[model samples]
Target: MSAPAAPASRADWPEIRTGIAADVHAFAVDDPGPLRLADLDWAGAPRLSGHSDGDAALHAICDALLSAAGLGDMGEHFGVDRPEHAGRRSADFLAATLRMVRDAGWSVMHVAVQVVTRRPRIAPRRREAEARLTELVGAPVSFAATTTDGLGALGEGDGLLAQAVATLVRPGDPARPA
Candidate 1:
């Protein structure tokens, strides 16, 4: 006659957290060549202006991951003031962010990002972008894009905007029963 163990309380369950973040970058009026987004290059597309490669999607994902892991935002670690990060690739930011998260005992479970823009539509490259992001974070990443109904600067083709949500879990924690 053995009794089953009591169900674990929510507080005792494995830690799972979600973080949201958004980033925007204006089109680079000066530089002309290709645009970098989600770690992929869009040839003949206008580039976004930023201290880095100006990949808004990747930047938002980094911020979201950091937020979920209770780490500081991207600017704190890779701000414009950081001379070394100037013109750095967005994928580099992602790698560094992942390291910070792992160091904090958290692993990214998933990330979803949405891009808002009027040009260089994302549909054609969604798969490529997701694959690149998943490879970089070692987690599943989803991407989508939309327009602002032609109402604002983004919709008018002035810049790119990206928003992301990330889910994180503490490794080695007991999984919750379904």
Candidate 2:
């Protein structure tokens, strides 16, 4: 038989999208807190300053998910001006974002997040963080951390930063094997 006919168009393949995002928050000098990051509570570390719990990692992940789904960023969905979001948990943000992504007819394939911080070391807790995030998002989640090598405000340990990338695909798409 002759060579199989070339796919009629790109539409023959399932749609896939990727998104990248980042977030940063400075330590809260006024608020003494049980620091929350990657959905875990750090008893001794100081908390980050923000209207929410200041879990930069989760916030970045939410933004990435929203971006991938073409649903806009976190600010539009949960703005500081919204009094209800004040002091909200980043986990709540994550759950809401996941819901939004699902409602958009897309499912998360995976997510990778990198945290930039000088203190409250991440290696010791990477596995735990990954497990928790994976459970929350219903997808594979990777968590990693790095330092700025003493270059800026982040290097000074004044704040925490996080970056995330997410992949999404339509559920049950022919291109996606069960």
Candidate 2: C-alpha lDDT: 0.91
Q: Candidate 1 lDDT (Cα, whole model)?
A: 0.89
lDDT of 1 at 26: 94
Per-residue lDDT tens digits for candidate 2, residues 11-109, read 555678999999999988678887899899976579989999999999999999999999999999999999999999999999999999999999899
Error of 1 at 177 (Å): 20
Per-candidate TM equals 0.90, 0.90
Per lDDT, the best of the predicted structures is 2
- Alpha carbon lDDT of each predicted model: 0.89, 0.91
Compared with the true structure, what per-residue lDDT tens digits does model 1 show for residues 55-133? 9999999999999988989989999998999989998898989999998989789999999988787888899989988
On the 0 to 100 scale, the lDDT of residue 148 in model 1 is 92
**Residues forming the 10-long window of minimal summed lDDT in candidate 2:** 169-178
So what's the TM-score on candidate 2?
0.90
